[model samples]
Target: MWVSSSAFEALLDSGACACPVRLGQRLDPSGEYVRRYVPELARVPGDYIYEPWKAPIEVQERANCIIGRDYPAPVVNHLAAAQRNRNAMKELREMLQKAPPHCCPSSDDEIRQFMWLSEEGQATATVGSN
Candidate 1:
């Protein structure tokens, strides 16, 4: 459940954790998955199904799924959250790069300690004793 800083950075850079709307558009281009699972969107056209909030009022009326009343708008702004995560990861990478070579954890216990420090918002903390 944990990954090295480089691996985590690669994941973020790869957009593997993109928001559900992007994932759905990529994996289910035809919106079949959404239509099958979400009855409210079953009648929505492929263009509007994935991101119903962007659908115009006419489209919503035609689809019979109101953004707020029937389907509900997205609660979180995925783009903002992703940007914040990227910023945090960038800071962590900078901290790791500035750390002394001896501060790099080489063992499982050391790695765990390093991770604990990171989770505690102490990415600047020394990882291993010199």
Candidate 2:
């Protein structure tokens, strides 16, 4: 079931992560969603649309979309982003471990300060101390 970041953090704090959390992995490597919004990559091949940076110059010519010219290079590498998120989660969990005992965040403002919010509004993890 879907849960907000604060709720998910509460679950983790309660040691419920023993069951798997459905952290996302790469899907739609064809960039279907991306292409729908980013018209620059629409002409890109199905193989290269998801990884425009990896598209060779020849493919760029064929697609008429140059990486970094027609379409901006991905601001963050996917693997790097994933790793960063994982590290942030680890740090948050550690921070939670050291948090003042018997104190729990109650308000949305309080809880948000302890979580990471992606540009897409996905709450990835808790961050910062009180």
Candidate 3:
């Protein structure tokens, strides 16, 4: 399969990670990029936000025409970005762990079924869109 991540995975496995990164969109230098695209991620529920700088250097190198002096270097380290996500999830886990386990909020099986059907419907719609 054609996939880009395995290379990085190997690097990581070998411990050559001079700086690991998290992935996220941020307010581009002009702020227009963020203003236009940040809203798209709003649908992704959770306070944990991805920080763009966290993306690995290989990602940075690939920016080509995308990021330059015109663009701001990632404001924070990807390691930091990862930590932020971890902290948010950790907080969530702590909250859940401390609570009574009686919450049947939603059945995982049901959610999976609904997701499958929704994906199928979406695929059909996509096919029909042409």
TM per candidate: 0.62, 0.54, 0.28
Relative to the true structure, how large is the alpha-carbon lDDT of every model? 0.74, 0.61, 0.41
lDDT of 1 by residue, 4-55 (tens): 2245433334423457788789998999988999999999989988889999
Models, CA RMSD each = 9.0, 11.0, 15.5
In order, how many clashes per candidate? 0, 1, 3
lDDT of 3 by residue, 8-116 (tens): 2223322222332122223333334443566532322222224434444555445431233424556666567656655665566568668776433264445546556
Better candidate number, 1 or 2, judged by TM-score: 1
Worst 10 residues of 3 by lDDT: 1-10
Ten contiguous residues minimizing lDDT sum, candidate 2 = 16-25
User: Which RMSD does model 1 reach against the true structure?
Assistant: 9.0
Stretches of model 1 off by over 4 angstroms after superposition: 1-17, 99-130
* Candidate 3 backbone collisions, by pair: 21-54, 22-54, 54-78
Q: How far off is residue 44 in model 3, in Å?
A: 32
